[model samples]
Target: MSKQGHKTRANLPAGGFLAIGRDVTSTSDTSRSKPQVHKRELPQLSSGVLKKPRLDFSGKIPSSTPSTSSVKRAEVDDSRWRSFCAEIQIEPKQLLASLESAKEKQKPQKAARLICAAVREIIDHRKEIGSWVEEPIMCSALMLFVKMNTSFLLPHEELIEVLCSLLSTNFPTSSPGSAMAPLLLYKLLMRATDWNWRLVESFIDDSLHERQWTDRPSVDGLIVNIITAFGTRIPHESMYTACDLTYPERYRTVAEINRFTKVTDKEQKIDAFVMQMRDICERKGESAPRNLLRTMCTCAGNGNVRLLAARKMDSWLLNGKLQRYAMELLLWIASNIGQGELTEEDSETLSSLLKLRALKSKQINILFNIALKEILNNDKGMISAVAKLLLSNEFSANRFPYNMTMIHSLFSFDNRSASKVIAREIAQMLAAKEEYLRISRTFFREFVRSLLRMDFDFALFTSHLFNAATEDFSVLTIPTFFFKSLIDFCVMLPFLAITPTIREASQQRRSANGNLTQTHIDALQKFYADLRNFFEICTCFFRKHCELCTDNRLFVYSYYRVLYLAPAEYYTGIDQWPVETDVMQYMRVISDVPISEQLLCTVLEAGSDASVPIDAADTVDVIENLTKRASLSSTLTGSSMVPISTSTVLETIFRITEYKPPPTFNVQDENLPPLAVKTLYWKAWLISLIWTSLNTDTLVKEVYYNYPNLKLIMQIVLTW
Candidate 1:
């Protein structure tokens, strides 16, 4: 054997070779080393030589020999070789200068030629790969390549090919045995400036096409990891920007989008990857939710992917996937955590999605219905989730009213579509089932409470009320009842009502047109006017009784008992209009002299009977627990209303006043009552003479003649 072979054998210690006694080789045979040379000292190569050394063991390495691989290993381990790799660096400017110079000479392809030459040289050096693996050179090279030209560095045609070859499975490792090449590649991809997205898109496209990259057992998961790393370095706003950049125009073809999403297969791997991401997102911790959500929102702009993400979010909510933690995470994301600036598209898409829906409408609406159906069909835990999300402070108040309106429309439409028998059966079932109404009532009450807390300008609330009030009265009985109760509570509850900041809320609301079209307003006004006349007649009945009564306090107490109780009962018994009037009249006669006289002769004559009047002074005095009841005239003027007094007697009196009086009163009184019977009779006379002297109709007509438009404006403002 040649002496060069002996030296090669000496280097193969790990391969269990002995280098004892080999034949001499001629110096003229360049591939064979001389025996004399082998006898001399074998010193390690210096750093400079190791950096770009030429291997002398080519021919000495035998073909078909098991020992050939050992020679390559020895060269890699040389310390000087390792240092050369660590210190290897490229000056980007020089490389660019070289490419530009070549291109300037009229060789248009020269720039790529130079780049290709450089790549080939590095690959051929033999020592460069070893240096790259054993030292820190790889990270620096990757960073430089990415940081320099970014996406511009790669040719559009060659981008995918280059990335796949360069990013093969057998990546280099650090001293710690951690494969860092993949990580370095990932870091570079993430740090990719705007210029690099095209390259990324191309690379992703190629990866999805490759069977090894997609069809493997863990490939989908691996792809997810790649995406995660890629996502971490991208600015949140970039997603929206990218979306804007890609939408409706630039990538005007399906192929272009397919390249972006890397959708390899319609089923199996692709679907599994999408599904896996959705599941992970649903299960993620709070720390990960926003990041993952933003990532998904960005990457999942493709319609199918977006649908998937929406499904996952819905599933997380409905399946109690993460329980309360999921809700909290969703809230945080919905509330825009960590997002510095909101893009219009992001705001629109996200806000529109958070709205609750009971049935499908559009594509997005389908998502809402699916989620609701899943939740309703699956588990009771979902009930809590639904309530929390709908009632949560994070969601918008406008959503519930709109959604509930949609739901009611759906239910009514469905009911109408059913056969008469089915509809009747359903009504029977609903009537029979107490729990349904109870649940529905709770749901609606909470919803109405949300609406009440909304920052309503008078114009908005009136519009809302007017629109609601005009709906088919039969269909909307529940909502109208809710509206009435809500309004009453808003007026009656101490904290809820008495909005000092909006002193003109009532006036402003009355002035606003809202959903009440002119026809509706006119009808409401006429109806209320008739109601006023009826109440006035009842008031007259009470005044006559007050004149006959001897105990003034009892009469006053009984008057309040009737007054407080009448309206609610009458308002509720809307089906029986005149019968309500008769009952109201019977109770009216019990009022104390002054209150009875004021109600019959003065206040009811004004518009006080049309709308319920709350006296501010009465409320304040009541809250203070004073026994003083303002004169009925003062209440008519809305004096000093604060809150209803909690006084035991007053509260009791008010409670009793809310009750309907028992029947058996004489209703046929005509010419029997006369003046001067009591103070009530005298007060009634004083009120009658005051009105008779002014002649209300004549005064109103004269005012209208003087100011023609004033009556119209007053009608618009006061009709409510």
Candidate 2:
């Protein structure tokens, strides 16, 4: 047989496999006829045994049955051919015709050598085929093929090079193939066992410089995909390096970058990378790069990431923009993380960061609340740190309310050690300078009120305050309202032991004989001691700063009320009535100070009315009688006792007689000024004092009864 004929016969379909090659010498009609015959015979051959061929004159019919090895080889080649045809979107006959045309174009020996060399080259460099493909379809097809061939993996270095080249090309403008480059490269890199991060980073740097890749909407997404793939493979340190190199410096803020990139979730890897860089920087005792911090700001919504970023806030405190961002980041973390998760170091760091004067009041509030939570958890170090922060210069007048509120919260805790620490800091704040008084009077008053409401050890706070007040009387000159609040707190101290809650607790510890336990006795004695010391300090304060008393009569009245309500046992055991002497000295200094005519009329009016309405009082008769009495006294004594006007007396009567329940006497009066409240308190105590004195036949009543003039004076004073 001729060589061409043998080749043609060998190329015919074997078993049921499709014929991959055709005879080049055959005409189109003959080729078409031969394929039809094979197609008809293939199904029958596959389903059952081949029928015996009829005896022919042309020797025995050539055996059409294929050997086992030939059948297996044919099947494998047929599958590969079908897949290639499917991938290229061509029919088998069309592929065969094209192959024959290509064969006709080149000599057989040369074509064979070329085919062998190409096969060898593909086998040797199969891993690099992804980079060599320039067409988008071919690149995607090659990557898909590589994915199916599990044993083959492209080198990441070549993948990165291809990705960079694709990124540099303007896709949908220059070469549409670049559009699939990111996805193709992603698949290739995923299959790689190891990556060249430096090469990846270099590619990223180069790609970032090309505005087409980063600015164009269609291309930027592809670029981000490439970055995301790189992120998945790159180590954190290398990722950080890549971020530093690729992040655009022109975009100063996270918001700006987010707006420009429009790739929100894709930047999570960048966020993580920057946070790691910051942690590393902090571990090395260095400040995080400012850009790294700015990157962190973008991911502040991530609680864990924000918390990690908050640790480096100290370095950013000096930067105006970063400082604000850092503070906001901290606020977010504090709000999201568990309260118990805050560590002492975290609290201390927040406290230190709080020193920035640029912090907003709202930001300060959040930071303080975080510290406050730690304090309530009984973290002593946090307590101390927070206390210092409260007193720091950062807590300006704008933040004073929040500062005092924080202190109040700390004192509210049942933890004694925390209270003591907070108390010390509060004392320092109160006495550190006189300025806090004028600036934060209302806050301080509420703070003191809150502290008194809790079961706090009043002595510790009062003692510290008293010691500082003694060294500097100005300390006692905190706003009159705050000072009065302190006095009210002191007055309540002695009665704390007898409160129902205290009494019940003490009763539980009572001895078998029904006597108070030594613990209860010691507590009572401490209360008295603290109360005595407080009153003594007040006396000294009034003596030196008598002008303060004159300016604030409510404060003076509060002091006198505290003195009058204290049990006599407190003074009897003390030496020479030092507190009492100081009080008398203060009174003597103010003796020459003229009483306001209104005060005189209020006194007479209150004395004259027996059935005074608790809510309102009629002062008309009282004022007329006071005017007439002043005139009568002036005539009788022939002295220049000026007759006060009815309006002045009426004004004084209204001021003094405006009745409201007093807080000082276990009454819940919210509207009354502190002085009026104290006056009502003193009036109730005075009535009790008079009743007790009369019942006991005290010396003052005996004197009143013994002298006729004194009898008349007492009679007038007692009559309503």
- Candidate maximizing TM-score: 1
lDDT of 2 by residue, 1-720 (tens): 468656655644454433445446677898788768876776676444333331221111232211111111101112322222232332222333433444566433332222222222222233244233324334344444434432333343333443444443323323334444444444554444344333233333322222223333433333333333322211122222322334333222211111113333545645544445445455544243333443343333344444455555555554554555454444434433333455554555455444444334554445545533633443445566666677664345545434555565666654465555644555455544555433333343345555454354555555555554344445345554445434444443333323333343244433355555566555444443454454455444444434433244454354444444233443322223225654343222222122234334434444334333212222333223323333332121232223233233323443554455544677555644555444543343333223223233333454444435445545666794
> What local distance difference test score does each model get?
0.33, 0.40
> Model 1, range 377-425, lDDT digits (tens) per residue?
3333333233333334223345444454333322333322211222222
Candidate 2: pairs in clash: 608-720
Top of the candidates by lDDT: 2
The list of candidate 2 runs beyond 4 A from truth reads 1-135, 142-151, 154-294, 298-387, 394-401, 405-720
After superposition of all CA atoms, the RMSD between model 1 and the true structure is 20.7
Cα RMSD of all models vs. native, in order, equals 20.7, 25.9
Task: State the local distance difference test value for candidate 1.
Answer: 0.33
Candidate 1 lDDT for residue 348: 37
